[model samples]
Target: MQALGFEVLWKGKNFARLMGGLWVALRISLIAVGISLVAGVLMGALMTRKNPVVKALTRLYLETVRIMPQMVLLFLAFFGTTRWFGWNLSGETASVIVFALWGTAEMGDLVRGALESIPRHQYESAAALGLDGKQSFLYVILPQTLRRLLPQVINLVTRMIKTTSLVLMIGVVEMLKVAQQIIEANRMKVPNAAFGVYLTVLVLYFLACWPVSLLAKALEKRWS
Candidate 1:
């Protein structure tokens, strides 16, 4: 019991507090995902354009996001923006902004991939059905694009949820931050609190992510 360390959860409101912390992480990720989905779709549509200027700009944004470590982006959003722009961004807000940026880039790439995966014949078929350009896209292209993107989007959301753990470093009071607090508070009373608490944390994360993971896999299998 001491070695596994879960007993700490039996005390006070520790477990409840951990659940609240998890909600915080989920809230941030959900909000970020919402923004990313809308913006990413636009960015992805733009990416399919033939203009070199737009392509270059999108490519630059994608490469910049890929090249920069997310930790650095978090630090910049939380600290650097406050210093340079005098914006009093809270840790949670900064976490959301950073994550939204990351998710946007990721979702954009996925959308682009999904859009590109459509065969040229689909468009011609839509036209043969007497569908105009907008109707053709709305009825044919959009459905197919969404079908391809669905599984990947589920996977992306799971990644975003897990990545929310990093927000704790910026003092976002998330599950990991709560776990640390619980361990530190019980250091003397529960010598193995760290191990048990962290183990529990792992389980909580897996529980939260598992359903979505299963859905993504099922989608990939059924849709593939």
Candidate 2:
């Protein structure tokens, strides 16, 4: 235990770097989640429309995003897009863009699922009350759909947070990256630093995710 690099993390400089990296992860996830929620809701609503062409296009977009691995997406954003398109993007900016794209696709599917799960009777009742399409959706549909959507959104957020570790692959220096750096720096002296550093990172991820999980459960109980 003492042979591990736990002491490195306790050092002020490393701890500060760890916290800074964690904040980077948090910032990326929060912004991505926000952008994705709005885009997803609009796209998901469009997906349910009567136009076959629009539906097909939307489905294709969703499937393409779903099928691609996130690491591949990040690489494409960081390397392919920048080189091929002549777009200059910083590592953090690229990470946010890729994650936002991924989150939007996922959230759109969740929105579509929630909207579809709402019984037809609810819509019928709204129509019977002389409610127009927009009114019906705003008053009768959105509130109920929100109950289901919130938990799923929270789950997506946790996933995005966890996957932020992948940003390290592109040299983003996020939490896991900082941990790896510390381990590498101390590997010879501590001998067992790799295991301790990773264990600490795992604990940090758990700490980050647990609250969102608890929030989802609480929302479920409250809304159910």
Candidate 3:
């Protein structure tokens, strides 16, 4: 048992290589999350507007992203575009783009819900207090909407982080892909390496996600 641990953990810097792959995953997820937050908030805000054209456009985006699978989107971005448009996108770039699109749709919906959930009286109260549309949204409406959105947004962050594993399908060489490589390389000698390697990957993902989950719960409790 101890020998198996040594083989998996210490053999040829396998752990270090895995950590590198994890870094790749983390970097992609973070970039995607940042883009999604900015774009999603704007999309969501537009979705709540009374303008028919804006609502229709945002709705189409939301539904398209909601209906498409992330894997398919990744393939389309990475492989299809190269064939059709001559734009050769890297796997990491494709993964980030796909995730940002998915996250935007999700975050936009959450934001829309949060914004709409604000009571009509709040708007009336803001108007009574001499607050114009901009002032009411900035000072009165946005804060409450953000408070409502916080937990769900954090949850989406965790989801995006986990979903980054799918980038492996497109040859992104993230943690899971690294794990598979390690297992294949050691299949001859360290027969039990798969268990250890995959278990380590699992623990890594759990560690990354658990704190986000806790933060979400804490925000929910504090805001409730």
Candidate 4:
């Protein structure tokens, strides 16, 4: 076995460049998650409405996102439609846009589930306490929705972090891309370096994602 080189990962200008790419990925994920949360909440609220048109539209949106692979969505956003619109969008922008759109659909569904899980009597009780629909939701329903929503949202964030790896395929030089570069560079000297590099990348991903998973578990335990 090759000596495990902790120092290799930490030393020099290359490490800084690798981390810079990671920051780009993190930034994209953060913006995507934020946009998705707002879009999801609004969509979830609309889903709760009694309007058939709204329900049908929301269902169609959710189903479309569900049926499509994320890579396909990325391709469609980045490559398929830009020429038709005469709009110039970069790889990172396209990635964020696709992830936000995808995440909104997912988060909206998650929010709907959490909101619906609340006992109907909670709304009734809020109404009985002289709270109007808006007030009731703002003060009562929203709080409970948040309680349930937090764990799921945390889980989604971790998923988002992992999913960002896919963006490398479209030429975004994130962590995976950096690892691929390293593997290629080392492959001549160390024939099995690709395996080692990939193993390291896997561990890095686990390091990044595990805390979010743990946080979700803790929140679930605390709230449930």
Candidate with maximal TM-score:
2
Q: Pull out the clashing pairs in model 3.
A: none
Q: Model 3: how far is 98 from its true place, Å?
A: 1.0
Q: Output the worst ten-in-a-row residue range by lDDT, candidate 1.
A: 215-224
Question: Model 1 misses residue 213 by how many Å?
Answer: 2.5
Tens digit per residue, CA lDDT, model 3, 121-185: 99999999999999998999988998988878988999899999999999899999999999888
- lDDT score of model 2? 0.87
After superposition, the stretches of candidate 1 with alpha carbons farther than 4 Å from their true spots are 217-224
Q: Judged by lDDT against the true structure, how good is candidate 1? A: 0.89
TM-scores, all models, native as reference: 0.92, 0.94, 0.93, 0.90
Q: Which ten residues in a row are the worst by lDDT in model 3? A: 1-10
Candidates in descending TM-score order: 2, 3, 1, 4
Query: Which candidate, 1 or 3, would have the higher lDDT against the true structure?
Result: 1
Lowest summed lDDT over 10 consecutive residues: which window, candidate 2? 3-12
List, residue by residue over 22-106, the lDDT tens digit for candidate 2: 8888888889988998898887788778899999998998999889999999999999987899987888999999999999899
- After superposition, the stretches of candidate 4 with alpha carbons farther than 4 Å from their true spots are 1-12, 217-224
Among all windows of ten consecutive residues in candidate 4, which has the lowest summed lDDT? 3-12
The list of candidate 3 runs beyond 4 A from truth reads 2-6, 217-224
Which lDDT values do the candidates have, in the order given? Answer: 0.89, 0.87, 0.89, 0.82
